[model samples]
Target: MASRSPRTTIFLLLLAVSLPFVCGCTDYGGQGVEQWSSDIPGGEAGDAVFNTPVQSAFTGEDESGTGFALQRIQPVMDGAAATEPRMFPVKFETREYEIDIDVNRSVYEGARTVDKALPAEYWYDEYRMLGYYSSFIGDPAIVTFLDDVLSPLERIRRSDNLNDEEFLELMVTFVQQIPYDSGAPVYPRYPVEVIYDGKGDCDEKSLLLLGMLSRAGYDAALLLFPEMHHATAGIRISTNGNPPFRTFTTSKNEKYFYIETTVPTYIGLYSENYEDAEAFVVPLGNGEKRFTRVNYVCHITESYQKIADRLVFMEATMAEWKQEIEDMKSDLQYGTYDTQDAWDDDYASYTALVGDYNSYVEKYRKYAEIYVYIRDRPYDIAGVYRRIENSNVMDITI
Candidate 1:
């Protein structure tokens, strides 16, 4: 698969039109409905944080107590170039890997101090400056840092004998494990700054993941959900066996599978909150690597969905059967029966209902076991397949 061209122009126009009116404040822990307007002239361009309204100027100190405001400010040149080696511990599945990188104080400060204002040409782009914010992923300074980060990951890949999909998941899980900075600046931070600060919001973390994946030779893009005021990373992977659960296609008809970076989630799984909202994909660099194990992931996702649906139906049926059995019992106790045969017939029917309910209970338990196994060992494709195959949950094979 080949990497596609950049769609900065189209992405900016979409951002301008989609996000006309936004709330002045946002709560990352909760999903707040944002007010939208289509009549606003020109675009309201702003930072990647998506919290502050375009009209509201940045103010107050961040949680770090930095004197800097959230608005676009001039870089404070301190002429410091000291480098500090830092270790970031990332946990994926049952294993924990420590990634070490040398952070340049000068680069980190420069990134923090860089101006975040959008160019004059963008119309109302300030509300979601995705095109502008994406530039940080390819910054010379950030690129250098990402190169160093990839070195250790490459070693881990060889040592663990991980396949392409597993390697990609490991890299993604690293970014997902980064502490989310609810009080981050309105502007998106450079990848270097995100690492040095040890935290980032959705946009900030997405940028970091994009850079890392791109540098590691994966065709990736940035997914912007303007309506939801959220962003996620996307990548081009082989969906040969089963279709992907969620993906955003560009005008050129290229599919980028959704990958949530702010929290730990399955690669192709998407959030239901923004599942109906429109999204735009901004392809990053041109890379050749593609995630080939999407078939395994799709099988697991499909089986999980089937098990969940069956469980729901079984629960509803059991509830109805229980109610019917209780009603028959009540009638037998309080209502008049014309004959003993009538009473015996009602009792037999009630007994049949009870038997059916018991049978469903056993089936439900079996399905639940399969569901839990897949949920817990999502990456263990063979194990999941064997568990499903051994039991009578459903006819699924990988």
Candidate 2:
């Protein structure tokens, strides 16, 4: 028996694959790639394909150069155990592509300071790398830690004329109190490290200050400098102040102050060394004591939609091949052996088909994640996609 060439086998497989999905010789799968349609049952009109029960879990990758853990606050049912819950799948199409956010404005009033003492646990756990990123720990514990240690600072909060010079003085005093260590453990020890040892780093001081200001009812954000590996938190300046340091006032017009959490006051805002750093600001959510702005955070979701779509398409193709092989086997049992040569030819063809099927199966089995990038900000979809695909997932910060 003679085997058919690989070209012939692939040609037949292609033909078998093309006949079913092709409608009038047109392809709907590859047209300008439509946004997720939200026209599914129980969905709003003109909505794109919407995924419900968005799984909120952390994923870490330490690929030498790339690593990041995807983190988000997900809704949890009361009295329910800690497990992945089921969600709905909604589909829709879009004429003009845009993400619809259901903003809850009723919750956010003006930012106010939480007058309670900062809890030492929240502050410690936030800086302590050991259980810092663990989901088991709640926000209250960390908040409490901040309150316990920074209580003194919060108590001293008064309605003062917070001018540029006064604000700089406060910043210098705070920085001078805390020590900076570049080699600190990834996790923070909080007041234990700062109070007892009188030492910490940019992130630690920032957290301490953040907890204090928030408790005092001042609106602030954790300003991140990724390139410089630093964090500085301060109130958002409402008006222009001095040239270097911007000033954002709190909910109380009288209580306005500028904060530089990382560096000592000696290195003023004009310190040219930290100029042009990559910076991002995350506004704190206003709770009972703290002032949280409505829709302050961006909704960023990363979907492996590209890889998922590819898997779906390939699986559909494999099913077609499997059906063909089954039909061929049926023919063999029915005494439809056209020739000995054809039988031998089918062996290699079946083998190659099996190989391709197994390869796709393996790919589908691997750790392919669908990152749904959601942010409260109007982000560039194309740019976001490019960053996720090109850079290490850890480098992706919403």
Candidate 3:
């Protein structure tokens, strides 16, 4: 979730469209080039990858500029009982599911103890700070702490027999449902802190999602938009059937599909704002998990787009027909036709146009209904598939 102004409203006839249309294009802002060149220690522009070492103790780097060091923050325990479990209610299609995880009081306290300020030497470097942000994802303590929440998710996936893609959706939607709070600290919070507070901004939510995804064995990365000061999580999935909304290929040949966590959008859908912005992909882990349901989601995405286009086309056609009918009525009233036979012929043409216009109006209404159904229920893959399969958009004559 990159920091952005209020989104513009999208208008669709008969129904208000919320999600942005998929552009079906592949543009990775830059070809995975490091945009934060000036922020690096040596002032050299290099590929943005995690080269820092993970440690449990704070150690300053030597002035030789070899590598960066990150302090590992651990939760402080006062030997108290764990706090009450936080409950997250998730809705997938028509079924309602609940996930409950108990956060230890010390874990929340330890997260607060972690310092976000960069060293004085690199205080002015935002890229260095971004490196610090990336370190949290690989933090062993934080990764282990998130397991409490992950256990329930695994249980649900097994109990419901959800496939890889469905499970990915479940994990993503769960994070999306977390109330977005832009008021959170500018620096990213640990996943435990996000869970404890039950709210996070774009970076916070995106980090949490990437952590969970990596822990679940999915190849995930953090997408950084330096220009917009926004961040999003990207996952690598099979594209054999349908292409992703947008993608960035790393220097290592890994292709990551963009996933927006601020809003409850489908996996392959992202904001149009960052569609053209350059993104830096920071790989979290080398997990082998991949989503294989692109074909199913692709069908729903393509169908929704088709209906939307038809509605626009039909609306324009009807408007022209309506104007023609009005003009003919005016001519008849003014006796513009020289002979009675001419007037009769004009009147017949007008009547035929009016009938055709009315028929188009009826068909437009049906297409609109289908568009709204698919738009509103994007997560209902099976239901949307059925709705699209049962209705034929070609039947709506122009």
| The 10-residue segment with the lowest total lDDT in model 3 | 35-44
Candidates' C-alpha lDDT:
0.60, 0.33, 0.64
Clash statistics: count for each candidate: 11, 67, 2
Candidate 3: tens digits of C-alpha lDDT, residues 40-124: 1111111212222222111333245543434555778877886757888877766888878777678678878876543444423
After superposing candidate 2 on the true structure, give the runs of residues whose Cα lies further than 4 Å from its correct spot.
1-138, 154-172, 186-192, 240-258, 266-270, 287-398
- Prediction 1 global C-alpha lDDT: 0.60
Instruction: Please give, for residues 1-398, the per-residue lDDT of candidate 2 as tens digits.
Output: 12222232221122232111011101111111000111112211122221111111112222352222212123333443332222112111111111121211111110011111222333222222112221111133233333443332322222344333233234334533455655554443333234333555555555555544443334444444334444455454433233232333334442222244443322112133335544444444231222111111111121332333444554455566666665566655564567898877776676676676677555544313322221111122334445455545433221
Model 3 whole-model lDDT (C-alpha atoms): 0.64
lDDT score of residue 281 within candidate 2: 46
Worst 10 residues of 1 by lDDT: 32-41
lDDT, residue 351, candidate 1: 87
lDDT for model 2, please.
Answer: 0.33
Query: Per-candidate TM vs. native?
Result: 0.66, 0.32, 0.74
Better of 1 and 3 by TM-score: 3
Deviation of model 2 at 377, angstroms: 39
Cα lDDT of model 1 by residue, 220-300, tens digit: 766666555556678887664437456678888777777766555566666565556677766655566776667666766
